[model samples]
Target chain A: AAGVIQSPRHLIKEKRETATLKCYPIPRHDTVYWYQQGPGQDPQFLISFYEKMQSDKGSIPDRFSAQQFSDYHSELNMSSLELGDSALYFCASSPMGTRADTQYFGPGTRLTVL
Target chain B: DQQVKQNSPSLSVQEGRISILNCDYTNSMFDYFLWYKKYPAEGPTFLISISSIKDKNEDGRFTVFLNKSAKHLSLHIVPSQPGDSAVYFCAAVTSYGKLTFGQGTILTVHP
Candidate 1:
């Protein structure tokens, strides 16, 4: 089965710079979720979308924004990046209806802010 | 405030023994609970889940028990093997598919 796909498995950026991460959810999956895992910490919910529409929000920072495209893929854009933003960014997907709560995660994108 | 908590940071068990990991949650609104197993440098893999209406769920060698009244859940791995060594996380969901995760517990199964 095809799993969620994330771009730039590893990313390096400098302070005050901008970065964009992309995610391609599993085929037919209509819900996309973003999470961040800091060093020595568990994954934290950032945001989520359903069928290209904003569905729920979490602890995402003001400097970060995300949107799901018509193709069911999503992008997370971070501006004025800070060193503290360095962490493993994960994208997960799930089908709607009965299996909506069952999310399958991608490998994750490791962001390193220098 | 932290909604989910896994008090034990680590657990060591001999191979072929049963491994039990516990989790507690403060939010009563959470209606669904799941257990995820994660290896280093990898994303969390869903192991098993239990609905609020169900007291337990089992899959192969893994089982999840829910104590709704106590707001607690636990995962049991029978006859644990060395390959089962990994970090286990407990997650809860209320609505909108947002998962609140607990601090993971590292399980070390020694052969």
Candidate 2:
């Protein structure tokens, strides 16, 4: 059972800088979701995509953008990063719409904005 | 506003005892509820889920009881083990794949 794969398990950036986080979902999984969890807080939905199409949106900031590539992989790009953006960024995948968002999560990428 | 709420911030129990966690939701449109366990510095892992149609769902030692009238839900772990120690989050799905999560409750099962 291959789980979701995320790149750069940890990222450190300065305010006003840019960072790109990548995610490779499980095989045959068509839906990808991004969540941000601040310290001692619940995971907050950022955005989601299904089959390279934007399916739903959440509390994602305007400075952040994401896209699911043809390979079913996705990337979250954050520009003009702020210190408040520091949190654990998680990527989750689901097999298909049938599961109705029974997501399997990746280990997550911890972003630290200095 | 937070639709889902987990009032207890933490709980501790001895091994072999039962651990119960409570959750409440304000959204009546939510049709499904899920429980996820997360360790420090790790992503949440799905534990159990129940549909709005059912009042109770059991999986091994884990059981989830839903009370639609009260708009409440609870997760029970029987014969708790130290391995069960972690933070538990309750999530609700109204439609699509979007999930709204509640503040988690940390459970510590001491051996």
Candidate 3:
């Protein structure tokens, strides 16, 4: 079975609207990371959550935020979406506090902001 | 600025031939390096990795060599198969769990 799972394989939102994306980490894993992939580019780290806390955040705009619940499921929220926000979002997970290496990814969610 | 870089935008290889993908990084603090393979509409899949402590790591047909002093790493796929055709991304792990990725190289294997 695939390790990580992301919801809403595709999403479309209007400019200034809020978009919520969800992700479920692999069972028993404690670290979850989010990344954004723009067209013809490599994936960019967005944020990481471990032990129900924000472990690290990338140089993303303040309009983007993430939350991890007790169950290890995480949610990425984008407020006031812009056309530039159109991209593929990936969720990955690894074992707790383990070296930030060997992360398993899920099929991403393609977001199109109009 | 792109901390990690994969200069080659694309490469084509004949089936059963060796495919070498190179990556360089400007960050000296990156202790772990990894390569990922991705197909269209899919997230990147972990391929191989090498820690800063080790110069090389191999698994089956894939091998990753890391040179800490030069801040360079390369992935070699022996006897590449058609199924191996995908976009390969090189990444480096720094201070936190954040990973810096390179603009991927698309590899096409012709049978």
Candidate 4:
């Protein structure tokens, strides 16, 4: 079975720069979700999309934006990168039918802002 | 205010023993619960889940028990192996796909 794919497994950026992380969800999955995990902390929900539409939002920062493309893949764009913005970004996807609540996660992208 | 919580930050179990992890939630409306296992530098993998309609669910060596009255859930791993050493997270979700996770508990299975 193909799992979710995330780009740039590891990233290093300087303060005030920008970065974009991409996520290719599992084939046929209709929902994509983004989460952030800081050092020694649990994953926190950032945002989610269903059927290419924004379905819900969490603690995502105003400087960050995300969108799901027609191919069912999603991208998270962050600007004005700060040292505190560094963390592990994860993407998860699930079918929108009866198992919509079950999420399959990607390996995650480690962002280091210095 | 944490909605889901794991009181014990870590636990240790000998190989072939049973390991039990606990989780508590304050939301009564959460109709579904799930458990995930994560290795270092990897994403979380779904291990097991139990809906509010059922009190217990068993999958291979793992079992999940839900106590709606007490707003608690537990995951039990029998015949634990050294490879099972990882961080385990418990999460609850309503029907909307919004999942609230607990601050995971680290379990070490020593051989």
Residue runs of model 3 more than 4 Å from their true location after superposition: none
Greater-DockQ candidate between 1 and 3: 3
**lDDT tens string, model 2, B13-101?**
99999999999999999999999999987889999999999999999999999999999999999989999999999999886778899
Which one wins by DockQ: 3 or 4?
Answer: 3
Model 4 agreement with the true structure over A5-101: per-residue lDDT tens digits = 9999999999999999999999999899999999988889999999999999999999999999999999999999999989999999998864534
What is the DockQ score of candidate 3, to 2 decimals? 0.79
Candidate 4 lDDT by residue in tens digits, B80-108: 99999999999888747767889999999
lDDT of 3 by residue, A1-114 (tens): 657899999999999999999999999998899999989888998988889999888867899989999999999999999999999999999987576565888999999999
Query: lDDT by residue for model 1 over A2-108, one digit each (tens)?
Result: 99999989999999999999999999999999999999998999999998999999999999999999999999999999999999999999998755346999999
**Residue pairs in clash, model 3:** none
Per-residue lDDT tens digits of candidate 2, residues A1-114? 799999999999999999999999999999999999998889999999998999999999999999999999999999999999999999999978455436999999999999
Report how closely model 2 matches the true complex, as a DockQ value: 0.71
TM-score of chain A of each: 0.97, 0.97, 0.95, 0.97
Report the C-alpha lDDT of model 1 over B1-111, residue by residue, as the tens digit. Answer: 889999999999999999999999999999999999999878899999999999999999999999999999999999899999999999999985889999999999999
